[model samples]
Target: MAECDAEWELCKENIQPLRQGRSVSALHQALCQQQEGNHTALNQQKQSVHQTSRLYFTFESELRLYDGDDPLDVWVRCGLLG
Candidate 1:
């Protein structure tokens, strides 16, 4: 895990910066999900919210500096916004 963290730090500069920058943990989870062929939790939530028409905050939202802008932009850029 420490080795992965070190490598992540080294490659962070290559990731496109979002408004507040991407979450290292989120990126890690995304990579893990991809490797395991699992769907992302964020996408599941998005589907649920769409079907229920109910608002729910997400992990990404907690990192946002403002609420007006969509937090999915970062994921979209990373091709993780399923």
Candidate 2:
């Protein structure tokens, strides 16, 4: 588990927390980005978050399709359950 520990050490500051935990590939990619000066990824992340935040705010009030369940499950009610 030294490799895992090393990877975590290399990218600990850049890793974002998630409910399912960090992906190994994502951790490696972050390490590579850090080795490559890290500015590009930081800026891109900032812009992406800003755009997503704006989109969320703009469409959050209008999004009424979901009823707190998976919409695709409704296909079963339309005779597709067979």
Task: Quickly count the clashes in candidate 2.
Answer: 0
Per-model TM values vs. the true structure: 0.24, 0.32
TM-score of 2: 0.32
Q: Which ten residues in a row have the lowest lDDT in candidate 1?
A: 54-63
1-82 per-residue lDDT for model 2 (tens digits): 9999998898768646789987899889989878777787788999999988876655553344547566555444433344
Candidate 1 lDDT by residue in tens digits, 21-59: 878999899898786665566678779878554322343
Q: In terms of TM-score, how similar is model 1 to the real structure?
A: 0.24
What are the per-model numbers of colliding residue pairs? Answer: 0, 0
Residue 16 local lDDT, model 2: 62
Cα RMSD for candidates in order: 21.9, 16.3
The candidate that wins on lDDT is 2
